[model samples]
Target: MTATIPAQTGGDLPAHNITISEFGAMKALAILSQSGKENAGVRVFIKSGGCSGYQYGMAIDDRELDGDTIVHDRGVKLLVDRMSLPLLRGSEVDFVENMMGGGFTVHNPNATSSCGCGHSFRTDGAQSPDGEGSGGCGSH
Candidate 1:
């Protein structure tokens, strides 16, 4: 695996080759607003599992590391880890709300294959962080 740090600039906004849609940006804003303060931002990671290969892992964190890729969209601040930043670049994260369904979804162009649940995917030879790149979903 190529260890790549997300490219950066001295400009006000960080440089990004990724595309984050306005709709998704708004949804992320709402989530940040609802989440209690002190949370750093959202942490999106890759874990192994699902029918595809890798699953996404998201969590609210108040702590941030230096050099993390920070993006300001809508009303929220998002920080992507240096390692995961490259993988998530151009990926859009949005909150889906409905009478019967409400959750987060990622539209990642990097994913070559994704499970029907859309929670997992696989790319080139990357290993899953969910533990052995299988996420224990095979028995499920």
Candidate 2:
């Protein structure tokens, strides 16, 4: 089941939204159950660093902060902070499996360029402060 969390309108905030795939929901649920965190939500955020200037991060969290947007889709809840929402707008979270492994990946529309490993990305107007190049794919 694929569903989108509606974007918040008005004010200076940019229209931001996110989606979760059926496979992603299933995997998240299983992980939550296995980790005894069934009541927790998946927190998705972006931080400085990485080869592309910004990197994605996720974790299981039960506490909702002051500026968090809680999104429910396919029985999974996503917690996205205000700072990361704009950059992650129009993004989709999905689970993919290959010969190497299986994991959750983000398909970000705001990203103009992403590293080969997909863990880091750069937006059109954003640049890495360190001026790094996408040298090679690294383990997550």
Candidate 3:
């Protein structure tokens, strides 16, 4: 189920549904290169169960799961599984650095509301279409 996202920048990858900012790509590349893993990439996924019904997760993984959407930016691979693609469509992956601190940030167009922590969000009243609400981060 692997998909090659066309490169939006300088790479030869297929276009990706999600775009990674130059700063984000550089940051991710640095982390992956220093991770001591031979061929590691960044994995970004969404899980159902954040304060806003959905939470974003990221990590460095050496393996590519089936059905993963692989996008390359600034020599870094951004791996996103199929199920999480729709939730992240049209999103910009960015890395922000400031006096307060610095970290990865996802500016998702699909998120209707997000938690103060910026790691959880609700999708335009669709997170729970079955009339039942998903619990938040504290519930876990």
Per-model TM-score versus the true fold: 0.67, 0.82, 0.82
Using lDDT as the yardstick, the better of models 1 and 2 is 2
Model 2 clashing residue pairs (backbone)? none
lDDT of 2 by residue, 51-107 (tens): 787889989897788878877777888889988988888787888998989888898
Model 2, residue 98: distance off in Å is 0.8
Segments of candidate 3 deviating more than 4 angstroms: 10-16, 126-140
Question: Which pairs, if any, clash in model 3?
Answer: 1-67, 5-14, 5-15, 6-13, 6-14, 6-15, 7-13
The top-ranked prediction according to lDDT is: 3
Q: In candidate 2, what residue range of length 10 has the lowest lDDT sum? A: 1-10
- Candidate 2 local lDDT, residue 126: 62
- Worst ten in a row by lDDT for model 3: 128-137
List model 1 lDDT by residue over 1-140, tens digit each. 22223322233433343334567667666666688866556666655466566667777766666766666554455667666776676677777776968787788878877666677777765655455445444532
Taken over the whole model, the C-alpha lDDT of each candidate is: 0.61, 0.77, 0.79
